[model samples]
Target: MSIDSQKGAGLPAQGTPPVVPPSAPHSAVEKQVARSYNSAVANETLEDYSLRYAPKSFRRWSEYTVATTALGGIAYLADFAIGASIAISHGFENALASVLVAALVIFLTGIPISYYSARYNIDMDLLTRAAGFGYLGSTLTSIVYASFTFIFFALEGSIMAQAFHLGFGLPLWIGYAVASLIVIPIVIFGMTAMAKLQVWTQPVWLTLMFAPFVFVAIKDPHSYAAFTHWSGGTDVKGGSTFSAVGFGAGMGVALSLIAQIGEQVDYLRFMPDKTAANAKKWWTAVLAAGPGWVVLGAFKQIGGAFLAFLIVASAGTVVADEPIEQFRHGLGVYITAGTLGVAVFFVVLSQIKINVVNAYSGSLSWSNFFSRLLHYHPGRVVWIFFNIGIALTLMEANVFSFLNTVLGFYSNVAIAWIGAIVADLVINKPLGLSPSIVEFKRAHLYNFNPVGFVSMLIGSAVSIVAFEWGFGHGTFGTYAQAFSPFIALALAFVLSPVFAVLTKGKYYIAREDTLPEPLTVDGQLSGVSMECGVCTDHFERPDMAYCPFHSSAICSLCCSLDKACHDMCKKGGASSGPVDLTLTRASS
Candidate 1:
């Protein structure tokens, strides 16, 4: 959390210890080292493509490129739809205020979370593992994180389906299939392919997005004032009354977006290695494009609210209620002619841009879940279909009709998971209650850690209760619902430190002493390159390592998938000794 603490720690000096060769005696210690090495270093396309290790070689892209790619995912038109829905239901003033509050909280928590993931070359799953969730503890959170991706994928796909219905008169079933299928090919190659797709599409997406607003303002200056004065659809006067409990509950629903930082961190982990030459750009890009996503999101929400008001004023009561209808009306007001065609074109373009990100992130999440749970990774490409299949089922079931109920219930769990992660990254590490470096390998982590698990459990339980009960139903109820996100945030932040202290930081790192020292020249760490055992290709020093299990120096990607070792080296066992010695000892 503090740069001052990280700086000035010179690399291990020369002769401090010779590089431990992979040929070390086949003792329990050597076996443990081998398991750790193998677990952390395995398949580049599959492991690094999802949730395992992040090697220096993969972090070759510049910070701007990385950040831009990550932020590009936020171009989804859903923000506008969500903002407009909230405005119509809750009133414009209330929606605007709530959105601002949510953005601020997301930004503050995102700073530490984003920075750590990029700096450590770890994704959210791995970061959670080292931050006190332990190995298995974080697995539960991975399921939660994975659910966030798929749920949003369905939502984004549903929006695109609407566009298909409008533009081509396609049945919803066909539209869902089309929307889901198009993204699979784009995501099959992972970040390499996604980066190019995002870069190429972003400029046009942005231009189309704001062009209507510019036209609206230029043609009728009075419309802006009319929008500001709009009272809204709800009968309850002047927005819901301010109450701690009500505010908390409403904010909790909005704050479910905290999990989005996980997706952003996915790209950020690809940021170029932070050397002295690139530190400034790295920090700036990461901070701006990482957590800074909330800023643009907040604006979109407010813009949606404004557009919704305009639609209601111009089109009629019925049209204002439907998001597609609202957008159609807004386009009509701006376009001179071909209003229907322009509206359909804008909707399809926006939906495609956002849906690709949704499908892409979901595939990564599904990949992480199946690989760890089933121990069989078909490939990142396979998971894309798996994720889309889930979304297609949701569409068939007509999930959109219950969007409010679904999102509200989902927010509780989503906030809890994100809250625990942010707390560990921001509070535990700074207080020295957790390890400075992230330890993600199965061999170097306990199956469960209480710090993150307990925090998430507590936060979720309280928020769900507050949401279900009308504790803030009266004058105070509105405020409670609106501020629930802060409640979850506070609870997780406080609990993480408390739990870490209670546990005495024992679970933070499973095997500290066993980790190999950094490759160094003189007193400073100098970059060295080595070949990956699996791919038979060269990688940077941080990516290449010696593994004693297969008795070869393997890459991080190969280590993730080499289940043959059976984690024998991680813990002292019969397999830790040489084959001949173990057989002779057993017979004796």
Candidate 2:
């Protein structure tokens, strides 16, 4: 008998191979199957590279190099701008407390996310899919993650445009276009190109960034004390008493950065396999640069806060609110030669490095979202433009004025997703509530899981209510904002274990015995290879798979996007329980 007919012996098949069944009950699985097929067809170099499984051969870089390259993207000047803006608006005391609280939270949350990505070599999309979101549920979070990348891309690109307008007298429109287009070619090559670009730019960027601060410290020692006492815009009520609500709101805005761990993990996935010799460096790099990004970010924010205070004291209220204006005034204290030109040049250069990263990460996010939802991936290159196009539109519409509103609104959604994922990774995995290793492939995952989905929905709903209710409005409207991220994290942590107990971990892995290949000392799958049915290319054991619908072994990428099969081959036999029931009826 044909392999297809043999596999379908229990069920009646009118025509065609049993593996690729002619008909089946319609469900979300049908859509998933179609998407998987389409993604397989587009598995060219330009489209859907390394989707289903990460081949060991492709992971060639040293852990340190990968970590450094990833961390370099975080070297954004906008931290300073954000810090300065918050301080000038909220006063020194509030901004300082907010910065401290936000930094601590971001750093702590980043630890588990970074470790898993590095250990498993999977991006956040894959990570979320396995964590608890299930196959289709993760797709929803992918859209949310993509939104974070592009929104930041637009914000960073806008900053670049402003710098261009200041430095070269270019129109903001032209500057925005220039900023968006420049990153496309670099991103086309993906991680390879980004590493070189970030490495080369790091030194010059660091030098320019630190020179002004050093000069300020050496020349005007007395300015430091003035920074602490100066109140730029915040109104003090009843003797400088701390307001929990005001502090919470400011912290929420600053803590919106929690999603940035996704970008960091994208790079960490490239880290070399851990070994006795490389383990020290591997752990060091991961910790130092992984969640450690907040260290630098916090410092920059504080510096921005200090600079804003200095500007208020010197240039008065109008320019104090603008970070660029504040920086220009401060840098002038040091540079006697062409001070205006030097300051503008430094600002422009700093913004370009950061905006490029924003655009690049955004493209990856968009690519993941559309490829899964629409069942077609033109290429990563195509999405780069698609992402940029959105950002460009936002810029033209003058999004800068609405920055706080947009970020505040976005934080609720972003935090919910991040917190849910973190809860699963840190709390669930360790406590035996979820699978230890990430199970990202569609063939190996359920369509939906209640753990992350329920947690995020509940957390976001509550936080939104608190925000709208104005609980912290008495201190500063921003105080009510802090509730979202914490609520999401806390609820997800509590709910994941409960969900695991109820579901009994059946959804964590489809069939554990299916993964029979032996792993190397460092967890690398070994000693087997199979050819993809769609691409007809051979892959290592980890990248190869058997599909019951097609009645053949295929590569992981092919299985991921195959839309035709309807998942006829699952654990033990056919796709669904009804099919097996039908077979028993026929036999009787």
Candidate 3:
């Protein structure tokens, strides 16, 4: 298909159109202005289309490459810490069962979320906008996702700081600053730099990560048996056996990592469009790197538990949960000389690998959140510092000391948000309660959609109550308090479909896709390029949407940033009042 050579018919020529005298009222073109960004934001390489759809032209990575990068980001050591913490609080059996259960839930829910993101080449924020949350409704989800990034960033940064303190005599505060500041230069380049960094470092990182585990198995095979018997010297309520309360509380801590799938999808959004020729490789990549991250993560958590068991027998519970201390003892099994140095190296490498993703994905999340709320986007690069600064503050506050408390409390809200989106993608779409396709462009979405927005709010509210206060009393309250994450998940999942039916799915699309060119041609996204009426820049067909104010096609970013239009296109459907969305309960 040919690129549209002309600007919008409604827009005049490139130079200022000759109209009335200079003192006259501003021309129509002047009234059609939008907040613009610098070249840094406009350049796709640096920005990576943070707040807009990633076009087909830019998705050039091979399936293996994309999958490898996505999986590489999962090389964090937090799973070990989380597992160790859970095991210290609850015994081996409960921790094991909880981690496994949480892994299964995350894997199952992540399948639909990752598939839709890879298929549509949009980030989780954009996907949320169309899946069930409407345009503005997704801003809340963007904040949720952004919080996940910085929270993990602080956690990972803390781990790295611990390495600095152990390997060198650096103060913990100085180390925190060092760890937080280093990733800025790397993350500023976005995917172009990350793709290379993740790929090049994968082999060495993998070898370092597994070396201690393999050596431990070889040197002391009986340690595995001993771990199942050791209990971190705690009275573990059930005493190494599984208890319902222990299992539920442990699951809540483990499920906090559900938001990790969002970071994975942040990379999966770059996957090349699948075709018959690449079908095998594409599916393999998606399944392996998308939801398949949990497989490796589960092992890491279990491995962390074993390592903690080895150390806590002598090091005490406080030292056992720290990744640096856990690894030092585990790797000391064979590397008798300079064990601290070796372990510190591994910890630092692991932290860098994961924190880069944390910072990068956080920038995207912040960019998405602020753009809609403030209608001002300096650039994706600017937000990298904002995300890291928050993380550094949390790190200085010693966030890692209370890791389980933070993660466990956070799981309720995170699970609810992810659960609502998963339901829309997997259940509602299949049952015809929601649209089959993802319509993410701003021009085509309502301000809010109850199908996802209300479901998530109710789920979060109920689960948070369960988490804080429990149900009524007795055994039921104990279970409810412990399993609040699951409560959020179940409520959101069921209610998404219920709300979709009640709302009649009208809010999913605010206006029909009346653009001249079809989104897809011959079963694939059309490669046709169109000029944005506002920005006057060209974007692929998927990123372009018709603007009634412009009377021509405009790019999604321009539509998102335009404060002047006030959604004149959507307003036409409703005469005097707000758009008649059941989500808002407003009518003309």
TM-score of each: 0.83, 0.85, 0.92
Taking all chains together, the TM-score of candidate 3 against the true structure is 0.92
Local accuracy of candidate 3 as per-residue lDDT tens digits, 261-354: 9999999999998889999998999989999999999999988888888777678888788999988988889888999988998899898889
Of 2 and 3, the candidate ahead on lDDT is 3
In candidate 1, stretches whose alpha carbon ends up further than 4 angstroms from where it belongs are 1-48, 234-249, 313-323, 470-483, 513-588
Candidate 1's residue-wise lDDT over 1-588, tens digit each? Answer: 332233212112122222232334543433453322233124454335565456554666778788888988887766776666666666655666677888888898889889878876668887887777876687788778777777777777777788778767999888888877877666666777778877887897787677667878877768677665455663323333433433343455567777888888888888776768888998998898789999888887788777777766555544454446656766666676877676667666666666666666676676666666666566666667777788788877777666656677777777777778877777777677776656676644566888998898898777766566636567555554545555566787788889988887766544322223243333222245554444455554444334446544555445555666555444431112112222111110
What tens digits encode model 2's per-residue C-alpha lDDT throughout 121-171? 778888888888887788888778777777777777777777778778889
lDDT values of the candidates? 0.66, 0.67, 0.84
Worst 10 residues of 2 by lDDT: 579-588
By lDDT, the better pick of 1 and 3 is 3
Note the clash tally of each candidate.
42, 10, 0
2 versus 3: better TM-score goes to: 3
Give the Å shift of residue 512 in candidate 3.
0.3
Over all chains combined, what TM-score does candidate 2 have? 0.85
Q: What's the residue-level lDDT of 423 in candidate 3? A: 94
